[model samples]
Target: METQAAETVERVQPHLAESLPVPVRVGKGVRRLALRVALVVEAAGGGVAAHIADLVRELRVRGGVEIHLVIPVGVRFDGVIIGDDVLAQCDTVHRLPMLRAVGRADTIAFARLFRCLHKISPDIVHSHSSKAGALARLCFGPWKQVYTPHAVYTLNPYLSRGQRRFYGLVEGVLGRFRSDRIIAVSVDEAEHLQRVLRIPAARIETIFNGVKKQPLLTAAEARSALGLPHDAVVIGFVGRLDFQKGVDRLVRVAQNILDRGLGNVIFAVMGPGDFTVASGVSADATPNNVRVLGALSQARTYFSAFDIFSLPSRYEGFPYVLLEAMAANVPIVSTRVSGAAELITAEHVGVVVPNEDDVTIFADTIAVLAQEPLTRERMSRNCERAIESFSATTMIERTVNLYNRLLKEHR
Candidate 1:
């Protein structure tokens, strides 16, 4: 009966190739079958959404797999919505309501997720981001569970001691009993899981998030399009204008540079949200040298407009923007976040400052980089070479290989 069912699936989905095999226990022998995967994500926007999209696109091309997607209903972040084209790649799409914080509503989210997983009957259930990773793991099931926390909440330095402890406890418990595997997008994240959360080292795998190369504008062309002074040194930022993204820090850095009378330096932020509220400064009070661009589509393509790319993130798990910045041949100025050391191989490539540094430090780093055109040019060339190692193709292939190995062991 199982063999017949597999054959039927192959016949109906000819594009699947149906050649790759996963092992399943049957009587005294093992049987080969197509691996079925269900992906669940609650916070389904930004880099998390991009990661899932890349995985689905590549998995479909590889064939021998059935893919299902589960996301919150009407899930949109800062005007960024998941496209219908990405949803079309999945065999099934399930929607549930989920909140970013722990609350009474999680009961409903968990129940709906449980029902969705039962209907899909996937061989492996993969959950992305913190919210969905926590909820999906709590539901008991025979399917092997894989989790990827884009950035664990406990990693946030601003979290209260009590809040950090509580979240860490939840993650520690889940990591031990619920998860079959936990993928860390950077070595720093994997080490944190082991050292801080006490998650076993053996259960963790580091898989860097990848990005597709895109055509970028020249500095002059991008400046013209953005309505900025062509001769000025533009420092660019691209991320959510929220605490985690350190928009306040970005504002402070910009103010510091301007206060020093760096009249030729300017700042452009490309993402959705209110800078006035985030930076605790009224619209009229904001610095004249800083421009807040709310939600520009394909923000990475405009990277060349800036002499330097600034990432003031409080924390991250291999940011897609950083990779995009490299692909765009833009030198980076980043806080010592998860993936900085791994990607920014040398001082010639970019500068990474300590995360605890004052805004002045960040401002000065950008300031100094701006003056050295030759150094920036060398950094751009190195970025072009470094980015090739983190392509979407390599990331996808490693992920599929992980799945195959896990399924084989499960039998």
Candidate 2:
């Protein structure tokens, strides 16, 4: 792996902005220098992993950018898996211990990460998610730093006043001095950064994460593979079975539907992480109508089987799963979380419940979709057209452009 990675690094060309529509500016003329980028991430799963993978793949194709990955050692939580192809594209790979919570172990991880960054000495250090974002900022070096908070912790409505203040202070301090640029995946998230965290408007950039439009299994085929009955209406969910994702709320919504005896609907939940533990609803007690299908590779392939795709997240920075649902032409029934409202219109794409945790409203929204097949079909048609704007090409181009602008200023 080491030799292969070195060979990959050796093949990097010296045409950083050659493929980009606009070239990087250095003084008066265009400067063509190979930009070395080191990506630091701790929550290397779900949307975070998917974003990094897409970004790395696009950067590799564009050429002239030496990419390095700094990730934690061990498997990801929530059955989240990063493809091997993402790692193969990198010039070097560094694995160190990184805990989700701030702990004594972080001191050791910090030292190791500092050494790794010192060795790479990348032109830009791009950190994904909160943990990596916080760590990369504190270990200040000559490299310019860009932090993508996937979703800020302080956005959690359930957070206590004291907890909100504490996390806000940390984010403010980091955003003010440590980070060169803060990338928010949604405009709603950018507003939260300015309003809640009090980060300067100049420091934040809104970049909607994009997804590739891929062929997926047909409804019949997808249902057959998943052992779901074609006769039943499936309200499918794809995400980590955790508090942030509101997996427990999803379970409750499913129960509410069952209790009300609304249609022949069954909820199909798929993702990594223990459903019983995360949802606080034991496996034995799980309703027969709710099928916990653990996790699957390329889960989006089965989105066709879903009559309605549900996102019950309490907070999010533009979820990639919603993008996948849109790509699949699956009508969404999402809670009005950070990016949910932006992605989903109340009746155009799918219903967006105003309340995040209200089980009745959520269940009612799902029931409405199930009962009105024409509404679902119309929304599905809308999804086909709406998804085109959120293309992978546009996203990749914008990111590279951001890198170019940041590097030009650094020079």
Candidate 3:
């Protein structure tokens, strides 16, 4: 991997802007023919990857820009992934070693990565999520950097107020001093970043995340794939079974629904994470009423099996799962978080219950949706309509336009 990565990196001619590590500025009679963009991430398989995947596809098609994709593999950090299909869009791929956001090892590893990036000298450096966002800013902030904390850790509901405040302090210091631009995935998230990070409002740009528009699976087809009976009222959920996702809360709600003999409702939770005990059985151990399927590789297609989609996340940025549910035309029931998912209520495509520990409200909401076929149909259609605003094409166009505007300002 080292030898191959070295060869790939060697292919690029460092065409740095007058700003040194920043992209070259077109001055006088010079016409800038191409811009160099580097997208760095520590995300493996999740919404971050989905966002990067869609953005990379759109970027390559737009042309006039050379993209160098850096993904840190062979380590535990959640970062970018470059599958063969995703590689087709990138001009170069760098697979370096990455450590999770702790310990001195992270400093050592990313220091090496910083040198590699220095060699490439990207004009535009965009970092995704928490770890990469911080590392990239430290490495390239003096040049040109865009940091997108797909979801800020400080805003996670699982964290105590003090812990959240500490994280907010760290992020606040970094955002104000390091980032050239901060891309907020949702409007609510943008406001929170400004409030917590004290980042200038001008530095933040809210580009609600987007998903690919694919033909959705039929209810019968999705049910067949999941081996569900025709009478089952399926409530589908896709996300990590982590503290952030609040799968424990979801399990308790499922148990309550089952105990009440609420129609033939089946809870299908899909995604990977550490397990926790709920009622009697472990959520990862597979409870009776809840079918906890480990992470599905093609989850993007499985959203259609549900009568309603649910997310009980403790906190979130803009979740791609929400976008997938909309594209699949499934109504949503989610806990209110500071992220863009709150738009569900504004758009009338889904129900948003206030964040609380009790499962009674979530169970009752699910029961209500199960009983009202007309309401479900109306919300589902609204979800389909909502997909247009968050399409892949729209996100790409906005992002590229941002790139152009940023270039002009720096130039």
By lDDT, the candidates rank as 2, 1, 3
Pairs that clash in candidate 2: 78-272, 78-273, 79-272
User: How do the residues 277-377 of candidate 3 rate in per-residue lDDT, one tens digit apiece?
Assistant: 32235535554767766666677777778989988887888888888888888898999875534568877887888788897898899989988989999
Clashes of 2: 3
Encode model 1's per-residue lDDT on 218-241: one tens digit a residue: 778878888889889889998878
Clashes of 1: 1
lDDT tens readout by residue for model 2, 266-316: 999999889998888888888789988987988878999999999998888
Per-candidate local distance difference test? 0.82, 0.84, 0.76
TM-score of each: 0.89, 0.90, 0.88
Better of 1 and 2 by lDDT: 2
lDDT of 2 at 180: 88
Q: Which one is best on lDDT? A: 2
